[model samples]
Target chain A: DTAVSQTPKYLVTQMGNDKSIKCEQNLGHDTMYWYKQDSKKFLKIMFSYNNKELIINETVPNRFSPKSPDKAHLNLHINSLELGDSAVYFCASSHSFGQRAYEQYFGPGTRLTVT
Target chain B: TQLLEQSPQFLSIQEGENLTVYCNSSSVFSSLQWYRQEPGEGPVLLVTVVTGGEVKKLKRLTFQFGDARKDSSLHITAAQPGDTGLYLCAGLKGSNYKLTFGKGTLLTVNP
Candidate 1:
């Protein structure tokens, strides 16, 4: 079974348009994260949710928002997408309290292209 | 902010060759992890080291944690084409769930 999965694996939109990417994990982890990988392949954290509670919000622009409806789902919504938003978005999950709490499982990334 | 810098951003070698990827940081970490990512997919965890001066071996791969817990390295022996992937090193600080990941070393193994 695919432990972590993301929907809309490829998203192509024009500038000023809005889009959303959905992510789901069956690993039963308490924490879920959203990451952005730029063209230079630098991966940076965007947001993190623990049991549907916002825990970490990096200095990302307000145009990007992350919502977790439950422990298994986390979604990212982008408003007024710009060319700089063209990159890959990845979803990850991990336990919040345990010996292996730091170990994260990532899903197939969603490639976003903002024209 | 804690940062992990990886050297030799990219490396291409023939099969049966060995290589080493280094990840260094000025800040100490409570735990360090290494991950491998292939094209069109997310990264997959390869191993985690918690203790300083610890070493773990996975088949032909050897991972070592610096004695000061501020750095780590991954060495592959007789690398094969299957070993071609982007290697990432991540560090976790005390009580912080956030993982600081390195820029990654891209390895390409040719047959």
Candidate 2:
């Protein structure tokens, strides 16, 4: 079984469509994060949820939202997707928050293409 | 400028060669992490160096953290085809506890 897994590895939709990417971790983690990797291969943090509390919210657009159903799952929903949303979205989970905590485990990544 | 900048944006070498990837930053960090990502997959954490000037080794890989905790480096010995991937370094930054990632160095090892 995968320690971290994401659904619909590839998502393709129109610019104005709405979509959601689901993520889950079996590593018994307390924190989950979403990262966006653009075509340039620059990985940036988009959102982070620690114990169901919103922790890190980068300068991401308001159209994007993260919902953590519990400690093991973090889902990202995008409204009114734009062409700029075409990037690989990654899901990661960490055992804890501090530096000494276990390293983060990343999912296979979901590539979203908005045309 | 990136909070953490990785040099040589791209690297290509022959098998059994040696290479080093660097990640630099002006701001200090509590810890630095290195990840290796393959195509169509997310990054996999290779190592994390916490103490400044600390050096850790895993197999043929060596990781070093700067004395100032603002930078780090990854060195691979006898690089193999399996060693090729996107190398990224990140530091825990800001009050947000978010990772400041470098642009990443894509490595390709030729046969």
Give the number of the best model, judged by lDDT: 1
TM-score between model 2 and native: 0.96
lDDT of 2 at A76: 99
What TM-score does candidate 1 get on C-alpha atoms? 0.98
Residue pairs whose backbone atoms clash in candidate 1: none
Q: Number of clashes in model 2?
A: 0
Query: In candidate 1, what are the lDDT values of residues A1-115, reduced to their tens digit?
Result: 9999999999999999999999999998999999999987888989999989999999999999999999999999999999999999999999989788869899999999998
Whole-model lDDT, model 2: 0.91
Give every collision pair in model 2.
none
Using TM-score as the measure, the top candidate is 1
What tier of docking accuracy does candidate 2 attain? Answer: medium
Candidate 1 displacement at residue B105 in angstroms: 0.5
lDDT of 2 by residue, B1-111 (tens): 678989989999999999999999899998899999999899999999989999999999999999999889999999999998999998875345577889999999999
